[model samples]
Target chain A: MSAQDLDGGSDAETDGSGEMPKPHTIRLELVDEPGQLLAALKPISDNGGNLLSIFHERGSLTPRGHIPVEVDLECPPDRFERIVEALREAGVNVIRAGAEHFGEEVMVILVGDIVDSDLSDTLHRIESSADATLQDLSLSAREGTDEASSARLRLAVRSGRVDETLSVVRDLAAEKGLHVVEPLAEGSQ
Target chain B: MSLRLAVLGAGAVGGSVLDLAGDYGHDVVAFADSSSSAVDPAGLDPSAVHDRKERDGVVGEAAPEAVFDADYDVLVEATPTTLGDAEPGFSHVERALADDRHVVLANKGPVAERYADLRALEAESEGTVQFEAAVGGAIPVLSTISDLGAPHVTAARGVLNGTANFILSRMAAEGLDYEHVLAEAQDLGVAEADPTFDVDGIDAALKFVILANVLSDGETEYALDDAEVEGIRNVPGTALDLAAEDGRTVRLIGEATADGVRVAPRLIPQGSALSVTGTQNIVQLETKHAGQLNISGRGAGGPETATAVLSDVSRLE
Candidate 1:
């Protein structure tokens, strides 16, 4: 049978030696488009990856207006890294790279004039500037105005990057005149 | 297979089930609602069952007898959970079981308040009563526990009600008090009109009763009244204060132990599984083999609960 048939069939796809392709799971933030998922999958299959399962959370929209997708695929050990690089090179926003990427999690609360300073920009800075993944976020607008609003951010960063991540958050807060309540450590007021 | 099914109630849960069952090729024979009656041989036009009065109007002709006399392979009970009163719906379940018809229960009241009577009726008729939707809206907790042999389930706990949890999470996150958050939840259709069942801990209480019965081998003698019940009515902004003070948060936890079941609001440490469980969801179960297992997902709303009921129906042989 062809590789596509084996991958698409009910039974597990096995290599020439009858060994199963090693599975890797990657989380991607894709702009909701007609063929975004198909484009993402092409890199995996073209680079010799077998599809296992995909969880495309369409109803769930990220803060960046993109859908979060968790794709599980099987590939040879050598092709795994190439597939990841290909996905990134294709302009797919890789929220997370490998299973080890979600190892370290930290939650911090940003209190102050969140709305006035543009909360979205602050979050964007935290993610891109700090090299961290925004795992989840909870925002509360008590007065429903820029003067008084707060947000709780749950971030997943690489291990040992916590301090640097906190520094970036502190810098962003300083720039926006916001207060950071770092859960792992005390922050400057 | 053109299986004939009778929808006992046309509320959010029942109506959605009818819609899906019809969509999936199941013959929804008739809709028997407490409020109204609307039955056509071609099947119920779901739009007609939107209102309770409209449902009552359509089903009035068939009334009480139609439910008992209808030829159906399965009877779905989706009425609202009533405290202590097992009437009509309970009677409906009894009749369906007596007729050897498979019964699916999305209503916790009948299972919580009248589990024993219903179980006995099922035993007498040698029929099955599936209630996966009663405990956890879509978590598969009941089915999982049953599959795991319903081991010595010592304690069951976690965020039970999504509306209450959402309000509490919002209150803790944004420093908003109970009233404001509750109003938001109501506006979002997360909280009920009366809000008593949700905010007063009764909703969690009904779920606890169902879990207790399922884990206790259908023993309905457990005193739900004895179980302590507390709500977020008096949260006092403690979660916000705690978060501000130590970066911690609070969640309304419903916990039941071998000693007794307790439903109250508890402050969970930040990053704890409980705290991480955000809006409109639930998680936490402690059993024998698994020690402590956690399952979190949507715990309310018509669509989610309806999906759960459909999943249970799909498992039928």
Candidate 2:
């Protein structure tokens, strides 16, 4: 449970812990700043996690004008929770967590004046309220703010949690006067 | 007629080089990889090559020293691109060239990231590094440009990354999201385990650097940060829908003009070479005399990229 227990073992080999560390993929939203990625990585290292790789989408933009970062790391089960907590404490917006956690992915389209509807807030709400992670998103505004625009969202949710996510999405759409086009069910094929 | 060659880093591209060289009756001096245990001095047994075939024999042990001691005419660099580390794969190339061995490179990291330094080294040693396989796999973009009188390329752009294009194509065609399409690409092995290079525009940027170097009349270096890069990761499905509505398609384009060079995902009109469907790569070069020249073909994969290396070797001879 202590920090020393985590880094004591060699990177290639495991420490005295009986359990092997599991690999977890964490997606984060980071503001564009010098050493932002390194800043985000400090928590992972502090909690005894070994980095596998970093997928920093530099050109990518989130609602908060931040970059999307995807990190894969390996840590013991006990330290995994601490890593997450440390990341949160460090003010990192942990967008998604764990590899097996994102079991089902769904794509939904929303057609409306997305820009006028406070799109950023809407996306933040959907992610939090639906218990879903926004894996990817695309938006098209042909005529600018006054005209109709559509945004496509790729959401990853816990298995069997699609209904709740969809419900929240529907509620958000209704509130913002947007039309939601959901994909076909998994069993439809 | 036997060309003795040693390839450093037997990854997807390197393995293909070995296969093609072996097919053409070339004497493969040795296969050196990151793991030393995997070094095969008599050239890898054809079947042993087949066993580690998935990664193109890149995963096994690498023998960094074998490259220096091996008696080979050519060294092919197939290692990954490491930023700030000038000696990614071509460090082996440097050693081989220092030993007066020619180098054929499929790895762009060294060339794009360290063009000046490597070029200086190549000049000092008076050795040649032919990289016909660097820019466009089997497209002959580099050879064509060089042979076609080094046309005054005013502007250049293309759908560089096959994996990104494949993902975009699926997204446009099936209305699938990025994750679904990317997963499909990964399952098909068209993408790297760490797809950052492909998705984040580094791969395309590397190609642009090569193009700039080959096309430029003067010696100039393009900084990685200078290029305008936009990956398809943030490209929403709605953009594709819009493009579909507008009779256009989205393609990640790396373009250079007289004024500046830019690389980003842009929506181009459908039926254009850049918007060509599938995993094919299409490059449109605007030269002073030739006007607009379009070259299209398979960008990457074992067979296609291997053929590119063979073309370089043939040119060297």
- Best-fitting candidate, measured by lDDT? 2
Per-prediction TM-score: 0.60, 0.61
Question: How well is each residue in B196-298 modelled by candidate 2, as lDDT tens digits?
Answer: 8888887887888777766764456664655767677766566678667646666777776554556666656677556777788888777778667889899
Interface RMSD of each: 10.7, 13.1
Prediction 2: B-chain TM-score: 0.91
- Each prediction's whole-model lDDT (CA): 0.69, 0.72
Candidate 2 C-alpha error for residue B280, in Å: 1.0
Q: Give the poorly placed runs of model 2, Cα more than 4 Å off.
A: A1-114, A117-189, B37-44, B48-62
Task: Report how far residue A72 has shifted in candidate 1, in Å.
Answer: 51
Candidate 1 regions with alpha-carbon error over 4 angstroms: A1-189, B23-25, B40-42, B45-61, B276-278
